[model samples]
Target: MLREIDVVISTNKDLLGLETLINQIKNQSGKFEVSIIIIHQYRRVENLPKFLVDNKILYKNLAEQNLSNAKNEGIKLSRSKIMTFIDDDVSISQDYFLSSWEFLNRNNCDLMFCRINKMNSNLPLSRNMKDNSKKINYFNSSCCLSSSMWINKKENENLYFDKNIGLGAKFGSGDETDFIFSSLSLKKKIYYNSKVSMYHPEEFIGLDNSKQIYSKFFSYGMGQGALYKKHYNKNKFLCIYLYFLSLIKSVLGIFLYLFFFKLKNVIKYFALFYGKIVGFNNYKNIQ
Candidate 1:
């Protein structure tokens, strides 16, 4: 008896959010069976919520704290044809599961990236294309956010997130992009759909916490840079184009923000620009 979808959530120290997401998943209205796989990292089993035991939702405790590793563990434990990865802090629409199933089978998609809107706001959490669905390629793969992504394991049995470039890893980002690039390299069918959406909290960038904000953005930039280097051999033109595009954007953002006396924005863009350079140079060293 195979399940229709296995929703894998890699979480740590967010029991409240985890419990809320689980309840939301339970309330999801769909004809298919959906199983939840929780990869709890850096936490003791005793710290987990009691609902997990009472409800008998499958979960595993991992001592390691790598995002990619946690997600890979979920993949290993999953027993479904379709797997969906989402962050614990986010919430999905009521039609998320059914919509994903219908879209995948209707379009014969191997992997699909859905829109991520900010909770209670019309704006999106990240840059997304128009509402229309379209094929995803290496050039516009920035929209392939992992939190709202669904994958067909039967079509991509060998696909796995890169361990060296995620949140807890040295590079600290770009795990999703690396996964998308690998799928494209294998000629997998990938699509982006706005109809299948999830809601995430807005990323806060306050004036009082400029240093922390800069550090976070810099880490993300490093991962982006490493990602470009890692896949340079696979698609030279795409890599070069994206690398220079980021460089140019960061530079422009710095000058633009500086002119308007937006010190926070200036710091963010500068850190990102410098971090990318360091990451590109230090990729081989880290490996």
Candidate 2:
């Protein structure tokens, strides 16, 4: 039986980390035949790894399109039983593929995810690991979704990454999470393997009580709100009302922090509230 797999890395020019990840894959043990697909806007480095260029790695350049389109292009080139997606910034643990393969093969899930380990030691544990035993409830295609996953090749025609959702790596987000939700709604299994992990390097030793980290997370939260409004099936009127209420609460939370607490926390909550409002208002524009 052929146990070949194709891994697609969505990258820009993070060669410092990319080289390490490539080596990890090359060194992993399995009867798997591997191929690489890189979707990049521009190659910042002149010389890529010789092994990657000399072997089966295929590079597709779409100078101004969104990442969803790039991901779609990579999937088109993938020729194997299983297709995996990983981010450029991640360093996979040795057992990453082994765990992914076993879970995918055993459970027959097309959309699967693994745990993430934040490189920054100061971040809380919830951001890094999922309780291994709990069943995954929804699809969230961000670092974790792309860090490790398998999609059946034959199913490609039916599943194209929505270019509209993850467009341009901008304020737009949640395409992968939305995709997983779409797949699971069709009754396909989506699995979470807590043991499969990757290391995400952030700027700080851990996200200290920094203004920058809070701002980033606030943008992330707003993106999620946009996603829920776009794809969730709950009552529309209620959803809109609740979204507004939540947005207001986040704003008030910031004010409270301003009055009697950490200044960084206030900025974080303000950014999050702003992002949610912006995201929510922009949905009409996206369509």
Q: Estimate each model's TM-score.
A: 0.92, 0.79
Candidate 1 per-residue lDDT over residues 159-226, each given as its tens digit:
77888898988888899888888888888899998777788887662335888878888988899889
Which segments of candidate 1 are over 4 A away from where they belong? 1-3, 54-56, 205-208, 259-262
Clashing pairs in 1: none
Best of the candidates, TM-score: 1
Candidate lDDT values, in order? 0.82, 0.67
Question: Per-residue lDDT for 283 in model 2?
Answer: 63
lDDT of 1: 0.82
Model 2 over residues 1-287: C-alpha lDDT tens digits? 77788888876664444777888887776767788887776634345656567476776666655777878888888888788888887777677777788877777676777776665443422343554533455422333455555686555465877666664644555676767766766777777667666766653435666666665755555565676677646446655665677677788888888889777667767777877777766766766
lDDT of 1 at 66: 92
Cα miss at 107, model 2 (Å)?
Answer: 1.5
Ten residues in a row with the worst lDDT in model 2? 120-129
Q: Poorest 10 consecutive residues of model 1 by lDDT? A: 47-56
